[model samples]
Target: MVSIKEGNSPDTETLILEAARKVFIRKGYDGARMQEIADEAGINKALLHYYFRSKEKLFDQIFLAAFKDFWPSIKSELEQGDGSVKCLIRAGVNAYTDMLMKTPYLPAFVVSEINRSPERMEGLLQASGVDAAFVMAVVQRGIDRGEVLPMDPRSLLINMLGLVLFPFISRPVLSRLFFDSEEAFMSFVGQRRQEVYAFMCRAVLHSSAL
Candidate 1:
């Protein structure tokens, strides 16, 4: 007879986190339940608590990881390279969309969590070291180089993220209200991935006279 391991073990923490991620994405933070998470993890309530003391604690861990994963690509892209603003914007847009596509639920998960607890997000943002201030440094350099027109870098950053992320975050409503089909919505998003970069490049890089 082959020996088999029984019940939940230390490794079950990883299983719990995975299950938590799925549940959180599907249900959002306010709607998720400990019992549901335990069921999803194929474990009992006691084991769930053994891995994560509470739902809030579990969410905190998951949210921090998600935030870290989401922000770094844009940060690195902005911080690196000696290219023009057009090049930087295009690269950042592509990188941001690629990251979002790979983690489809991430935007909704983040927005839901932040809406639930803005203070918590503020603290996390402060600690993350990738805020408007850092992005502005990159944008200011472009302005100083005369590579881009004068504008509030933070406003531009916000607009860039909003354009790239809002469609995905509002996909269900957008699909139903406008596209009327998943395929149409997906196609639109695919097109926007390139269009967004082009729009940003044109808006930021071109002279006002043009």
Candidate 2:
């Protein structure tokens, strides 16, 4: 039942899930096969079916885990404030960007699956209880206090997500076109904290602060 434990152990369920995530990322929903997942997990198709029943069921389990893993980091990061709106936004953006970098395929997987499966998309929305309002309210406070410009809160949140997430979503093209190597690509992304902070500041901060 526990999926956190990795490596060779008696936890067939966890081993299956771990293997399935890798296969899903590598092959995607359309390309991923149950046999491939079972092979990756070092188990036969029969054993894999015993636990997951079907590729669709296996996907649902992985998708749920993926969405569940993402939200908490966002909530924790957005909730922090370092006494300045610039710093607060910076912290949140950095945390989110870093999380995406750590899990490179997650954004792409989500983007792809959302377009391919309407039912899976609904499941993702239901499973992921991410509160956009928290970020909106925090940014709104800055606008209210005249610390930020009177931009629409929704636009601000969307812009923040785009700035941080877009790079990850388009990593293959970005890396191939601009970056010389994988390390360089990662280094470029790593530098986006200040870049995004500056972008947000110029967009919303009219004329103030460090």
TM-score of 2: 0.86
Would you list the clashing residue pairs of candidate 2?
A: none
Q: What is the alpha-carbon lDDT for the whole of candidate 2?
A: 0.77
**Model 2 alpha-carbon drift over 4 Å, by segment:** 1-10, 75-84
Please write out the lDDT profile of model 2 over residues 1-210, one tens digit for every residue: 445554334588889999999999888889998888889989888987777778888888898887765643554554555545676677768777777767977888777776787666555666686666666777788878888888887887778778888888888999999989978999898888788988887887758653
lDDT for each residue of candidate 1 in 1-210, tens digit (9 for 90 to 100): 324354546467888999988898899888999889889989888877777788788988888888876774654665566655665677678887888778866888788778888888667876665566655777777887777778877777788888889998998999999996999898888778778987776777647412
- C-alpha local distance difference test of each model: 0.78, 0.77
lDDT of 2 at 101: 66
Residue 135 of candidate 1: its Cα lDDT? Answer: 58
